[model samples]
Target chain A: MSDMRDMFVETASRLFRDYCTPDLLRAAAAGSFQTQLWDAMVEAGLTKAAVAEDAGGSGAELADALALLVPAGANAVPAPLAETLIAGFLLGEAGVVVPDAPLTIAIPRPGETLRAVRKGDGWLITGAVARVPYARFASGGVTVIAETAEGPLLAQVALADCKIAEAANLAHEPRDDVAFNEAPAQAAKLTTRQAADVYAMAAAARSAQMAGALQTVLQLSVQYALERSQFGKPLGKFQAIQHNLATLAGQAAAATAAADAAIAHAEHGAGSIAIASAKARAGEAASIACNIAHQVHGAIGFTAEHALHFSTQRLWSWRDEFGNDAFWELKLGDQAVAAGADGLWAMLTAAA
Target chain B: MEALSFAPPPVSEEAERVRAEVRAFLKTELANRPPFKKADSWNGADPAFSRKMGAKGWIAMTWPKQYGGHERSALERYVVLEEMLAAGAPVAAHWIADRQSGPLILKAGTEEQKQSILPRIAAGDCYFCIGMSEPDTGSDLASVRTKAVKADGGWVVNGTKVWTTGAHIAHYMILLCRTAEPTANRHEGLTQMLVDLKATDGVQINPIYDLAGQHHFNEVVFRDAFIPDSAVLGKPGDGWKQVTSELALERSGPERFLSSFTLLVELVRALGPDPSPAAKIAIGRLVAHIYTLRRLSRSVAGMLQRGDDPAIQAALVKDLGALVEQEIPEIARQLIAAEPDTKSTSDFVAVLAHTVLNAPSFSLRGGTREILRGMIARGLGLR
Candidate 1:
């Protein structure tokens, strides 16, 4: 294995083994307590992995840094890792100073729009950004704003600069809608396209996280099968259970490969096709694996006492975080056919 | 299970030249051949064409030159297979023999067997069939009831094997039979033997038509069929192990799921430009699936090259690849304006027709979807 994949496996395994317990997942989901796992991750320099060395980070490659977050999704470790790491990397790349605390970003719904107008010495942003993850805890946010003359622009605003209304999702991730009522903010150097690109990258990372969570759930289900016995032998020995695990393993493998490819593409400047492909595949695979894991684990998998739900729940949440399967599928389809048959052939063979 | 990190380094210029040479050979050979003809490639099973390939020293390319082989690298062999499949060559005649049986005998057969059989197989003058599946035993080889009782100098075999592809045309079969008394454990006491189809007495091969109305498969029954001790592959009780190893070869190839590739190419050609949104979406999803399957399949190949069984990985590929291939026809039906006609002369239409006809067997042939999922679960340590 490459050092990068090894790092990913090791980091992900640790979170599943140590912090992402059933109790921890329940606490995080119930909004009752914050798991210290987030602090531990930051202490381990995971959150700042993609941040530049100049910005008090390891300055690792964006893909490598993003890999660390996959396990977080698998374990459903409630933290601001995705938001903070991505925000930190973008800020660091643009020579902006990110706070020591975590940061996240939010976009308006697909049809909605946000506007940022120039005022006095700063920019005044007025819009509502929904489905913002880790908004309650993030110290700052990177918001997408559309300007009448400039097209689209990404701006960074402190949490104190905007109003946050707590929001809850089906998968138990913390979310909120942020309404900026003429909130003053500094303009990020990245253009709308750049911001979109960054968002796609983050979405790819989120997919990786979902992949990781699915893997964890698979592991848990397999473990359960071995210990849970019927008909004088463990269920793991049965062909039925074997087939389910095999399918899940394939799904997990697909998720990993797709996410890795996406990361590689992003690192090499391959553009949206790579990200779209990864997000789409990861979304589908994660959803399938999550459902299968719960099904295989049966009643236990659904209970709060079993840690399987911790990972599976996160898989469910992260798959929709950046871009859902439907969204990325359309994006990839448009680009692929638009490139024409020859273009599609080139892309397919080019990977070889 | 690990991500594919190291590429096989880079091929030398000479190696690249060799690949180009092979490509040139294929181009010349297939210039006048319709693209749809290439769709069946190896699976198309034309003996004459296979003989021509053998004449080019393509069959058993990795074997030593002394045994009618070219002593090429496995990677070189892989290139040939890929090119052949991509071009849709009719390689079925020598496919099994060249792929596994020849290789297996090379590894475990006696000097006499190698001298008599390997050369003929390399020449593509002889064909081989698998005698593993039985009426009682589907893919669960351990449950096989084909008895090969010990005799003075040989053995007497009696059993019925169903769904045996190319039985009527094959010269010999790699048979798995019960040699010893049935042990408490199902996988034990079985053996593999090379049965001569020409000399075997009381053996009947009956054609079994597939859904496509193709007589490509058969049910072969052996009654007191005799096989000398030398014909045995490896030792008794090794059949289970050997067959399991053989599956890595059987399941890992591009053929496991590429059966629908011709249809995909045809669909693209038929759709042309400015495809409807629905068509584009379907194609996009299919392409993504194909891409993912290729990567997974490549990883399995890498594992095999490194001397790893990767049975679980192979099963994973087969399950997913089958699904992807099976989905192609449905997607094509929705995307294209005209209904597929299997008997059509048009290359795209014909390939699509063939794929639609053959798609159901995709999940059923190698191992049923249910069977594969069970294996995957086991590999994941699930019950």
Candidate 2:
């Protein structure tokens, strides 16, 4: 990372540490968006951190911006910050002006065509969005891939124009279903990627988020082990608990490494295998890490009053959001099989 | 937050180039290698095969060129090591010397020792064995009672070293012996002595076969083995420090995770491209694990190359690696119904059999899981 990237990370870290408190997270979970937190992040230029400078935003490198997601997610900042960054990038690419409001992205299922035809002065959009993150709270708009008469295009459509049946994920954040029946869309940019690329992008982002959440839960578990005493000793002193925490640490490290691999490969072009590996590995890590953390925390972590669930619940939700372990496992395993025994080595080594 | 830092280190383009070359070489070299032999990974020795690697300057890769090394970067060496392990190359003949012992000599041995021994090690012709575990010592390495009394020129050693891998085949042993009486600190007064296995008069090497009847482990006893003044590695009392310093070098590597890689390759082969969703998920889990482990292992390599001590990180890699590795056979057991048989000609069954028998020792060697967890706990500031 360059000095500028380091500064960006430091600023984001300090901001989250100062503002993203447990109270803020709890309030955000209870159906209230944290405007002050989002405003602070926006003022810091982090909201448009993924957009191009020529498109009117902080033009941080893709990998650099993605890396910041780790610390942001680690802090449990309780906002649609990553969504806004991604949405802003997509909007900027289409020459659309990014709004001051918070943003969310809608991921379509694999191989379902989205159509937008010319209607009056605007475009008529027809698509069904499932598991749309922050759909109820995307104040700026939603970034979606739709098929127009001009072929596939990345377009920005407002939330108010679409019919949304709001839902929530395991973490209590919005995962609404949005139906765009001839909803007005504009400033669309042409794209070549399919639903798979969208899945990869979402997977990459979620993998980073999972890495951050797992790291925090590991810290929580370790802290709990150090404080909670039984049998005349701290839990950390017991070999069984120590081994469990050690295993947790290993899982956390693996998750972090997988995320890093995704970020690094994103530095190159179109990260396919790296994204698959990241999502699959990080999801597995999240499963192991979350289970061990809860086990280590005992009954304390099960309560809503405790903060461990803030991260663990988010991990549970995020692992399945973009593409779950089973979803990506087939993709990677299929690729590995097609690669054959001879091609497997090349695929593994090609990441370098 | 400051606990075990395993940030995936960046590899250079040079390392990637090295990877391509290594892969191409392995494709040609291992085209006809049997799956059973490949399943042994680093423990399967072939002197001729090792020499082939030596001819390519793949051994002692990160060492200085004067020591018969290729003068490659640590990341470059890492690429080579991982590619070999993944391909199940027979690297046992030079694995120890290239991975740890030669590096120890380079770090702490005298110039004369470096010139005399490191070149042979780098050449891949000279094999070395670890003499850390005594008959009474396993994870309690500090409890070693092997003693060497001060003599005319240097010392006369007498002790029994058990579970010494490759003792029957290795040319030299980096033996750790107590030079003085153990005080409150058992690690105190210990010394590392270079032993010539063939030339040593009082040494006896006896086979200690494992459950699978492999010949790697041995019990070597010395009655009155002579060590000259130049044979001492590092300072006498600093043996503990020296041995522990080289541990991260030994623990974190592709070998730790890639021991079961052949089984994975065979699993993939058996499943073909279109297995059931259950099989895909199972294999994908293993793929995810191996990929993550490889990244962690590479990060350790980067740290080692930068001359940093990543002991805690190495422990984490080894422990998690063993867990996933040991789990491979179990998972493969469910994914495929073939009965494991070492004598079977079927690649999948043979590799599965080989891995099932050896999986128990993954955590047992390179410090047990309990010990590694203890180290990790200390790293986390828990102890």
Candidate 3:
């Protein structure tokens, strides 16, 4: 890691640690936008970190931006910091002025379509994207790459112009259902990228977040095991609990490695295999880590009030987001199959 | 949480350049070998092949120049190792010596020992087997009953070492035995001694065939085998520390995860291009795991290169790598229906047979899963 990246991580972790309190998380869970948390993030210039300076934002590299996602996930921050960074990158890539407020990117699910048609100077975008992350709170508007008759077009549509049927993920983070009906939007031709690229980036983002959450889960489980006792000894004294925590530590390590690989590859120019394999491995780690964590924590972890759920719920929900483990695994498997027996080793090594 | 940190491995141009050369060599060397034979991988001992590797200056790659080493970086050595394992190249003839024993001797050997053995090992003419595990001791290594008593100008050793891989073929054995009586600390009073298997008197090696019916393991009985004073590896009563200091290198490597790689490669060939989604998911998940394991393993290699001991992280990799390696055979059977048959002419079936039989040893070797997890738990401050 570069000194710049280490410094950024230190700053971001401190900001998150100080602001993302349980009270703020609870308030956001109870139908409140993390206005204060998001404001602090913006005030720190983090919201513009992934955008280029010429694009009216901070000039931090894409990797520096992605590195911040780990701390965000670690604290279970009740805001779309990852989404905003990704949206800023995509919009900046399209030569659009990056937004300065909370932003979200629109990735259409299966059988869903978001289409854009030229309307005078701007384009009109119509159709719905299911479970668009934080769409209800995207004050900077949602960045969507909708299909057009010519090909695919990039558009930025305001939340007020679109109908947002509010929804939430497993952690009660906003994943609203947004529908657009000939909404006035600013659309441009994406000469350098496509919608699939956005999906991969988002998946990588989720992977980074999962890595962070897994770390927290491992820490929480170990701390709990040491504090809680059964049969006159700390739970950690038992071989069973120790082994479970050991497994959790392995998962956390794997997830962090996977996420770091994905971020590095993405920064070097995204290799589809690296991103795909990362999301797949990190998601797999999340599942195993969550199970072991909850098992070690026992009933206290199952309850809503326990601090463990903050990280665990985020892990459960983030693993499903930006395409699940099975989804990325199938894609990677298809690549391997296409590479065939002779080419599989070459493919994997070449990506490395 | 503090014990676990696998930073991304740094890329090395020199390592990448070495990778191409290694691949080209493996391509020609393994072109005619059948997949069934290739499945043997590092377990397939071929001294002639090992000598070829030595002639290429590929053995003892990271030692000092005077010790017949190339003085290359650990990253370069890693690239060579992974390439060999991935291609299922026969490396067992010099694997243990190159990976651990050679480094151990270099680190703690006497100048005489280094001059006599280091060059031979670098030339791949000398092989070494670890004489640590005894009949009564395995994971509880400090409790070893193999005893060595002081004799004239040397030590007289008497004990049996079981599961000593390559003991029959290895020219030397690094024997870990009790040099003094046990005290409150079981880890103390143990010492490492170098025994010349061929030259030593009253030392016998009996073959122990694995389930795969291969003579990869041996039971060596030393009945007062005289090891001269010059054969002592390090200071007396420091065997426990010396042996354990190498665990990170032993536990973290591509070999841990790439053990059954031939099966996966053959499975892809059998599945063809248009297999079921289930097949893709299984293959893809396995690929993801191998990729992640490689990252973690490489991170450890980098740590080793930087002179940091990553024993806990290494344990985590081995434990996880073993899980994935063991899973391949079980998962392969479900993706395609075929009884594992070593006699079958089909590459997939034969590789499957070999892999299934050998899968159990992946976790058992180096350290058992339970033992590694215990180590990790201790690293986590649980013990």
Per-residue lDDT of candidate 2, residues B1-383 (tens digit): 55557766765999888888998899899999998988887998999999898889899898898888888899898888888988888999888888889999999999999999988887779999999998789999988998999999989999999999999889999999899899998889989988989888999999999999888899999898888878899988888999898788889988898888888888889888688988877876777777777888888888887888899999888998998899999999899999899999899999999999999999999899889999988888788
State residue A275's C-alpha deviation in candidate 1, in Å: 3.2
Docking quality tier of candidate 1? acceptable
Per-residue alpha-carbon lDDT of model 3 for B250-339, expressed as tens digits? Answer: 999899899989999999999987999999999999989988899899999999999998999899999999999999999999988999
Tell me the spans in candidate 2 whose CA falls farther than 4 Å from its real position.
A111-113, A266-271
lDDT per model vs. reference: 0.74, 0.84, 0.88
**Candidate 2 CAPRI classification by DockQ:** medium
Give the DockQ ranking, best first.
Answer: 3, 2, 1
Which residue ranges in model 3 land beyond 4 Å of their true spot?
A187-189, A267-271
Q: Which candidate is the best by lDDT?
A: 3
Give the candidate order by descending lDDT.
3, 2, 1
Residue-wise C-alpha lDDT for candidate 3, range A83-155, written one tens digit per residue = 8898888778778887677889887765788888888888898898889888988989988888887787878
Q: How much is A139 displaced in model 3, in angstroms?
A: 1.0
Residue A327 in model 3: lDDT: 88
- Candidate 1 on B227-325: residue-level lDDT in tens? 889899898888888888887787867777678776776777777777777777777776667666666676666666667677767777888889888
Q: Candidate 2's chain A scores what TM-score?
A: 0.95
The candidates' DockQ values read 0.32, 0.65, 0.84
Can you give the TM-score per candidate against the true fold?
Answer: 0.86, 0.97, 0.98
